[model samples]
Target: MNVEKIYQGTADKVLRGIPASSGIVLGRAVVLRNEIFVDTHKTIQNEEIESEIKRFDIAKKNLVAEFEESISHIPPNAKDLKAILQADLMMVEDKFMYDSIIKFIKELHTAEAALVIVFDQSKQLLKHSTDELFRERVTELDNILKRFIIHLSKGEKLSEISENTIIIAQSLTPSELLKLIEKKVTAIVTEVGGITSHLAILTRSYSIPAIISLKNATHEISANDEIILDGYTGHLFINPDLTLYKFYREKQKRIAEHIKELGELIGLPCKTKDEKPIQLWCNANNIDDVKNAKIVSSPGLGLVRTESLILSLNRIPTEKEQYDYYKTIADTAYPMTVTLRAFDIGSDKYADNLLIHEDNPALGLRGIRYLLAKKDEFKIQLRAILKASKHKNIRLMLPMITSLEEVIQTKKLLEECKLELLNEDETFDHDMLVGIMIETPAAALIADDLSKICDFFSLGTNDLTQYCLAADRTNESLSEFFNSFHPGVLRLMEFTVNAAHKNNIPVAVCGEMASHPLATSFLIGMGVDELSVAPSLFLEVKEKILDSSFKQCQKNVSKILKTAMLKDIYQSMDV
Candidate 1:
């Protein structure tokens, strides 16, 4: 039946959230009720610690086996899932949790209560730990307690469900969700989760529709109600009218078609309608991302965030290790360019080992400032990049350089690093291209001078817009002012791009703004040399370039930048 013929339903309140992943799919609602069990304590003699340990051992073995089985079913290409499984394996024999359980058993003498205390302590531990490994370990421990509670309460095994169900729950531990590997589970909806929560990451990896932070989701959603989930819009509908269903169904079809077309376009050069070549680059964080880029036929790596590598290491990676990692990408790309941004740490992404904190991290010591404070660490990274450049096409971009003085100071440090390498008789490329991120208004204003020293400029519009408008993007209260389409922001960007061009320096955009299709044309029209976006968006943006003309984009940009009102600008530009 056509959507036009479907009966209309009463409008419901619409809630909004950030779309972490993009897609459209409609499936049956499989409401998952989170099973919570109370722990009972039993007193055991100290002599029984060994016996208790044995019981714990057996439980862990069974749990590990279950998790392994689940991991085996995950596609080999699912790096995110594999990483989660690795975390589970790392935490399987957690010494602290096991010892705590054993101690509780010996002191209180009750296995059941000891198990309860262990589970509770584990949850507390997970709360304190930001490492995905530790969190996954806690999830594993929680699963054990859940099953034990179920068996103690004489509850039935979790019912095997069909694939088209939307799994609803108060919270889902990674282990529990992974175990339900039957393909029928089409979507996940949880009442609890932050933006960076494990469930959110899993949902993104699986390409499933999810809604989190719904305080009343578990209680609000009924079992098996025909539902529609627009993950792109973060909207959940119960018994949606036929019109809505038909609309989304067609949307789903179009999305599938678009993805297929993009896949086909892989390996082809990205060119505009006028045959002007635009560099289509991918943002990569690690070796896995580099590998994934090749799979999607991305021509180059735009931004290799070094912070991810540093955070993953137990200690600071040696210069050699860093060089190897950088070299791998450089060699792989060969002739293709890779712009590795210097560690851009601040706010939510600082190295734990460094222990650097600030009153307001966003505005405080971060990016090049933090690196400058720790000169030795910074030099090691610089030397590594310089050495790697000997082998492949690699360019350096400094992050958060607010003034030309910072750029001058950074170049001095680079010179010192180069001298040290030379003294060590290290044969490396000293002619590597160097650039700076134009993220702040001050940087944009001084772009003319900065362009003289730097080889290129990359406009980080995400932070540029935030700083220019004096509004934090993360703050929902000031979202109105955080508009990227604001005339002020576009003017600043235009000025920076013009400044870079006048100096014969190419300018690229590697911000979230660049990923928007509407903004993509505007950026091209503003004389952006390249567009660095998420790998998923690479081909789509390339397609838009092929379909659009520079003249039309220039006209759009002119209209957009004329209006002071963001909403009016967006409306006029059809954005």
Candidate 2:
């Protein structure tokens, strides 16, 4: 007699992966269980050692060429892929990895085993390293190995474990993850990573449902097991009951409908029901993001982070390259305003061979300080922005400005750059507007004085809230004080906006605070002229603003300011 399986056992020790993006997907699990193998050709005669070494050299050259060729075909629109290729090339040329491979080949007596041993050892080191910097280095090394392996395996028999699969692996490098086309792989689940990890960022970029840090996911999930993945709520159900299945099926239908509705909003004006027009803008890091902004009908680009371009290149981008990049976005946005912020680098984002230890990096030497210290580099960026402004609507903004003196010095530097350009007969937009980000309390309090010199102000509430409340949002222990609606924060914002308006300067809010549905109304009432948020949240925020009244927001702000403590203000307001 034959029997059919109805249910599987419960996953008692199952660890769940953190969802990076949202969607429900069901598919067979493809287990890419990789094992190192050594392919040894027949032993060459003693006299062939010189020829063997030459062959290994040729193989290395050909391998690198092949990788470059494949990378060239990756869409220029894929910023994540571009970043991975940049990092991978660095790894291939790293002295440490190269020396290890050479030593292995000389001692191990075969090129194939030598390569495998070097890769295996590097992988082991990556798994064991406690230092984050070392771990990142190892991750890059593993990327090189995986790419080389895949390059060799091309056109060969690839064991397809299943069709319409979800990839379950220990951890996937960016290159490996990119190689899997979206149609075949429904989702990606890994055993390690936080939201900022490369794989997580890439998954979010592609709008794919990904779950990370699921310990032993590869061991627990069996091939071809019908499972339900809830990316929104980070839930996984294995062989769910009939009732649960029906509920998820209904949920899938609702999600599809909602997405369709959001699609309809594309290219529509982001105006409130009362005819209050809000400038819906997109935060971009590269030209691809600029293109995405056009698709979403973002009226402008709020924050053009230039760090992505700098990090992707082997060396700092030349003035001409930077000019072209900035110009591309400005020309694309055309009449819409494009605000480009100077490089914001510090602890985690330090340039090569320049290290600075800080007890609290968020408050340490970053943003303007880093830029000022490297005057030449800072001037180059300013020159690029000035040149780009000649063709498009461009605004230059300084980040992490805490004092009036920093603003004065930055303005002076800009003047010097302008004068130098004039001497070189290169015409620039001398009348380009300059702005400063009010992220610190000191900056907020002195906005009146700063506004006298600067053209505009943008409130970075993410750091401002953290600084005011003396709470690190990353620390779960301080979760109670991370509230943005707190009386203290609201009061500061009110003061900053009032100060800017008092001096006849426009103010905008560009942070997580601006994207919140309830907070958007409050900000507009606080006398802010603009609210810049991500493109994905544009329609929802617009809907919220249309449903709300500016009059009510002002009334709520007044009530909150009268309260004594931050917590009391939050309790009084509905938000």
Candidate 3:
């Protein structure tokens, strides 16, 4: 792993990490730091106020221009990063923020100090945000502010990188990543980040090969050392031998071919070989989700995770804020429906404000239980969803409902929220369909009763499977037991689907089960009307469905239901 040894083309090889993006690359290593130091706490004299404000304005313009320039260089399919960059751009152009900073400057705060004060308030709030994802955004925004301050004070710039360079670092903020991207950096390796991190999202958007959470990556990787990055597999081969090089080169070609095939299926309907029309939708966390879903011809958005918006901004959004955010998704999806799920808050999503603590958070006060107790917060969200439904096709969905009583109470609250909106003369959709996620065993078992009140049912199989099996999906030690395709889990899905259909309601599978190609056939066979998944897996699942006959899939599912063992189910699928 040393520089000399790597150069000699023989060293410890094959580092595994989280696959952040998919692609293959062979290049020399380039190291990067996560942030640039800046003095952001200085005060200013009255005489310096105008000049300082001018300086701040100039830096803001420059940063925005840089971000806009970066957007042009990235691939068109990289809509996620493009939307993110546009959001940052919106923040830079925020009139209220600008006025506040100018006011601070007039009050004798230095330009940098004013900038720090304004953004620090947002950062502090984000620190306590519900989801860990938004907390990560706080750090990202901090790095961005620091970079802007550095640009204003010292005119600092990114380190120069040569072509075909793979960036290795302890961490990378989106701003810094873009800097390297401008120099045509080939790939990236980071020691810390997750699938939802800005770095991971950006890499995927840009189609860059990236592996994250490779512990001690900076310590092991040397500058200018030859490295092979297989981001699809989360493998990094250092100082690879000729044989290893040839193996990866061939692997790259196969992956490229597979992607090309998948790409060709875009815009095609997801109909089975027997001509049964199956609806394809996508789960979305933000506006980018709607954009991606539309690109893949997803007829609608199955899940618009509202909690992410709350966490990302670090607070419960105001009616206006929520309206604007939801409207953006509605606008993006246009005539297509957007199923906005109510916040399924829990201790696990970093919603400390929602719950104090629970010994077993998985089975604790969460989902509908938490929302019911916090009626005011629940009302705010419901009202917002109703208002957004005025503009585009929208369906309001309640998450984590485990009983008929919860459904009844939620409907009552929905009526109350609608009445309040009517009193205020606020425009909203009065007839928007309200659905519930059948994620709990209790919910699935009693789905017949719940479906009577619900307009639709969307299966959250990820949680349903874990709850049914009484296993934590995240617990590596219990990994063997966290089977979503278990006979018991499949039976619950079957039961829920039948219950919805019995009531003449449409049911969609919007969980990880639907995204998997192996499970796609079985789910189709089981009479699932719709499948909602990540946009990246759309074509893959579509291909599976197109090659299957619904009648055959029904037979396969029937065989699975009668089977007693997990091994037998796999044997039936030839997995």
Candidate 4:
């Protein structure tokens, strides 16, 4: 119901900008801006100076954390984001700059006010610089700090965003763009960011329709304004006429036809060329995804991200609230089954009480670790999941499992929840399955032991590859090293899959590896019992396996397993 049909989408009044990505898209607009304007100067009381300085220090620390979080979002424009990020820090740490800020704070200005004065003075000095690099850095520094200011302002604008939407911003960062991409934002327009800058080139690499350097785009484009963007020509039209509307609407249909074609394959029997049946499941985080999965006729959900369903409010949801939410999806996919993973918090995500500062969050308390640490909250979650299992179709999955000891501990807790539900006379499924996500090297290394104690294993290849290769995708220096097809990563997958099968348990590839074009057939050959992917790519992945003979896939897997180079991995799976 939140979805807007793009067929009626159009644009009338035109505005010119720099074409960043080459594509055409029509959709509604969502304008993003900072809640606190940078230019505002607030005089602080002399007595409040101490607290103000502390606030500034905290904000500066948060600024660095923001930059670190952007690591995973480095774009095509910044081929070496690690170095670029270092340069950004050096600019902020300049002696004269931080000194000027302190000087302003002594003059009784707020932290943001002090920053603005120093920033303007610095820019004035560089205004006439003949060095092109100096001129460019000035612009980069301003954009980076302004975004940090927005963070300091703490405005997360309405969390409810719909599909086929275009984002217009005073300025945008590659990290911001990546987050929106996850929500299926159709296009982008921004007042700042150059065609060669990090934000612009990223849009190009992602094949999204976008334009940059559109002056005052955040003001010119209002929210919900139906607009047409010609990314090839750097033009945006607002409130388009019937004629232009019809033209773009027809073009939109032609473009969407290919995607629609893919969905048609979903209803067909899923199997390999040899008639070996395989399960193709879809992943969902909300109602829209559930609806899309239903349309594609996904057999069931392989991953139900419970956090996304509840954490948008950044608070702990009540047990009834969690039950209603999970029950909706479980009932919708009834007959088939839905696997609801417990709140996988940590990293960039937090749920109220779970919010805490960590120098390295990704490797810190997250996923099942967070849940086990917060046992009372964990019980509320388990009880809700159990309460929703009245249809006998909802299962529980634990993420970030690193040991059989953790599995035993979780199993003990799950049993407690089941008993509580029975004592309360709650209607529930007693046979609900519990599984562990084999994401860590430690977990995969002990998959044989885990299989003996767990109902199933879901290979979270994204984390597995990162852990196995000791590579972080955000660190551009390790771009080549952060490969999903690295031999070691693949070997781990094979080892875990074999362990699960030998123990008479099912194994699934539920990460991006399942949906990768080359990896799909190879995974099929590797003998994973199921492949779980986003609903949008469900049918396409299913078709990839259907076109592959099990024998050929087995052969491809055999050849690729022995390859030493990345190029050879591709060649082995080339056919």
TM-score of each: 0.76, 0.71, 0.67, 0.63
User: Quick one: ranking by lDDT, best first?
Assistant: 3, 4, 1, 2
Instruction: Write one digit per residue (lDDT tens) for candidate 2, span 198-241.
Output: 77667877777888766677778776666777776555666566
Candidate 1, residues 431-550: lDDT per residue as tens digits?
888999999998999999999999999989887988898886544345546677888999999999999999999998988777876688888888899888767667778888888788
Please report how far candidate 4 places residue 279 from its true position, in Å. 0.8
Ranking by TM-score: 1, 2, 3, 4
User: How much is the lDDT of residue 396 in candidate 4?
Assistant: 89
Instruction: Tell me which residue pairs clash in candidate 2.
Output: none
Number of colliding residue pairs in each model? 10, 0, 1, 2
**lDDT (10s digit) by residue, model 3, range 1-575:** 23233334444565777677878998898776544443556678877878888898888888887777876766665555665666666667779878988888888888777888888876765554333454565656666676677668756545567777898987765657877887788899988775557887778767788998787788788877889887755778888888778877898888779878897788677899889999988888766667778888888899888876764564678878988888888988988889999987765444446456554545667778888988888888888888888874999888888888888899999999889889999888888898999999999999889889999999998779878998755333455687888988999999999999999999999976787656888889899999998777677778888889999999988998999798888878755
Worst 10 residues of 4 by lDDT: 1-10
How far off is residue 147 in model 2, in Å? 7.0
For TM-score, candidate 1 versus 3, the one ahead is 1
lDDT at residue 247 of model 4 (Cα atoms): 84
lDDT of 4 by residue, 402-444 (tens): 9778888888998999888889899998888999899898998
Better of 2 and 3 by lDDT: 3
Most accurate candidate by lDDT? 3
In Å, residue 348's CA in model 1 sits off its true spot by 10
